[model samples]
Target: MNAIPPAVQPPVNDEIDLAALFHSLWEQKLLIALVTLLVGLLAAAYAFLATPEYQVQSMLRPAAIKDLDALNRTGVYELTPEQAMQRVGASLESYDSRLAYFRANPGLFEALRQPNRSLEQTFESFNREAFKMLQPDPKKIDSLSAYVGIQLTYPADVNGVTLVNGLVEHAIQAEREKIAADLQTVIQNRLNQLELKMAAARANYEASKDARIAELLEADSLKRAQLQDELKALRQQLKDRRDNRITQLDEAIRIAKALGIGKPTTPSALGEGERVAQGSVIRTEVNNQQIPLYFMGSEALEAERNALLQRRSDDFTEPRIAEIAKELQLLAHNRQVEVLNQRENEDLFLKDLAIWREEATRLRNLSVDVTELKLVSVDQVAVDPLRPVKPKKALILALGVVLGGMLGLFIALLRNGLRRGASRHHSDQSSLSS
Candidate 1:
């Protein structure tokens, strides 16, 4: 009997019963249909009631060469088309610039106001996500040109078109103003430098002029002193010679008076001629040797001495004295130094005066106007969109139906399993009671 009990085998149920599962699902088909209908209604309500969003886009490209020519011609600054475009792009991306624009134009963003949020918070959120800058992918080889685009996604009620276009214009204007201001600053700095240079030149010229005046005055003083000393010496020498001549004449006059000679007489006049041969008359010796003072006659010497004593100035007696007087007169006042000292505007005499004045004048008069200058070429302006991009009704409704059907099928299978388990439990109780 124990050997026979060992031969009993356990049940094997690896395969699923497809038929029973299908029958149970079919029995709960009404419940599945009701759940699917309820879910479908909710999905339809959401698809129809949701607010629609619109996308407005604008395309931008680099400015043309001619558009930036005016700014580049200043010589103080240079900007290319690409650089201008980059500046415009940077302005567009600046949050401060956007806020300024938004504050300046209030009516444009009136529709974006929310009751639960302040204006600043709303604007911050809008600035963060409402605007998008689209550029070509760097990894893509098909990109032919460097193009930028601005896209705005907003509610249908908002003026997306006006907002995008106005933003672009504001960015361009901001960039233009920046360029003009930078150029003006450069020109002003150059003018300041030139002014400083001119001032230095004037100061240097005045200093040099003053130094020249001092030098000329010192030279004139020294020359005048030297001339006065030379004149005094010459006059003294002339006086001494006159006195010596007078002394010699007195001595000669004493000798002549003692001999009783009253007129200029040679040796022959004293009877020497009678002793010489009749045909050989002695001639008066004439050479560089001065004749004796007594031979000049006392009357002639007395006359010359009286004339020398009566003369008021000895300058006329010597040629060198006259020359010295004339030189002293010339050194009395330096005409060049006087002219330099009396000058009111010394800058005019600077060697580089003309060059500095010309350059400074040009800089002061330099003007740059960029009011009409175009910094960017708007390839496409935003237009009112004809359709919305959000609220995909068809796709949402399809997903809702599919999900509802799956949930309903799962509920029906669980209910059928519970009913079968209840029936098995009742049968087991009845068997135990019997």
Candidate 2:
């Protein structure tokens, strides 16, 4: 019973004074009201005046430079993801190559690398301003990122939309022009090489024209004169031999007619006429001698004597063999020279034409490849942007209001504790004086 009375009489030291808290809040009512009102006004103003900019985001799947012919050949309709990635990498090479000031011009690479004072100054100025704005904004331009499309937060206003659209169009045009210009450069280089070759040929022609012409004409004239002389000699020998053969033939024919044994009749037709008008007299003589020898040796003696006149004369009587042999030798020499000249002319003409055709083909193939790249483009349309299904305003505001009220209540309690301690100190002094 004593412990219970003492427990009832003992004062609690740690108990929070709710009345003091209420009094402090009542005293600081204006300040609390002001703070609450200010917070509410700020929140409302932010909710109303702050323009919510919608970031229009749509995905872009990279469209590879596909060959319709590949489908026709393989019958496969689509590329695997790996194959698509490979194509994306290849296309990225253009971007990387042009990444140095957008493929400004020839010698641009060297110029960019070189540390010129003016260029360094320009770069410094650009980087200082660019560091804040540039911030790797892929969506600001039609940048390729793993074949994905992303647009950064931008105002849905007309100027913002126009800026994005213009950048995209500019990037596309730049890519196309870069491809075309590269083609033109390659073509121009080949053309220049061809022009150089042509110039060299023309120069060579000019330098050696007189000498070449003189050499060709002189060689041809000398060959023609020599061949003509040999042909004339051959003709003379041919004529002399022909005349001797004709004389021998005539003698044989006359003797054959006298002897009545020009040719024996064939077994198929016993009554057919003898064939003797155009045959070599020597052949006819040999046949007649052989035939006569079988019958009687003395009968072929006249035929042998008649055929001897057709023999190529080695003596001074006609000199027909000697003349024909010399003529044949001269004709052979002239033909060799003529063949050489003809072969040389044909080889020279063919070689130059082949070189010209090869050069033309190289230039044509390069131009074709360039043309193919220019035709690839963005084949997509923009639809309305999708709404973000996050951060509902009413819920966030309610949460913020609750959190603010709790914080205000804690601060009020802290003030109340300090005031209660001051009150206790005043009471202790009053008790000591009594």
lDDT against the true structure, per candidate, is: 0.82, 0.47
Give per-residue CA lDDT, model 2, range 1-434, as digits (tens). Answer: 45532222325387656775577888867656555555555565555555544443322344444532332222213344334433433433333432433234323223224355565454344334321111225556665443433243433332333333333444445555654565567567767877777667756654565466566657767766676676566667766776675565556555555655534422223234455557554332223333322122223434554555555642344455466456546544445445444554442533274686577676655423323432223333334446422233565466555655555566666766787788888876776555
Best by lDDT: 1
For 245-264, candidate 1 gives per-residue lDDT tens digits of 66777788777677556777
Clashing pairs in 2: none
* Model 1 spans with C-alpha error above 4 angstroms: 1-37, 138-141, 229-318, 341-348, 355-369, 406-434
Please give the RMSD to the true structure for each candidate, in Å. 5.2, 16.5
Q: What is the lDDT for 332 in model 2?
A: 46
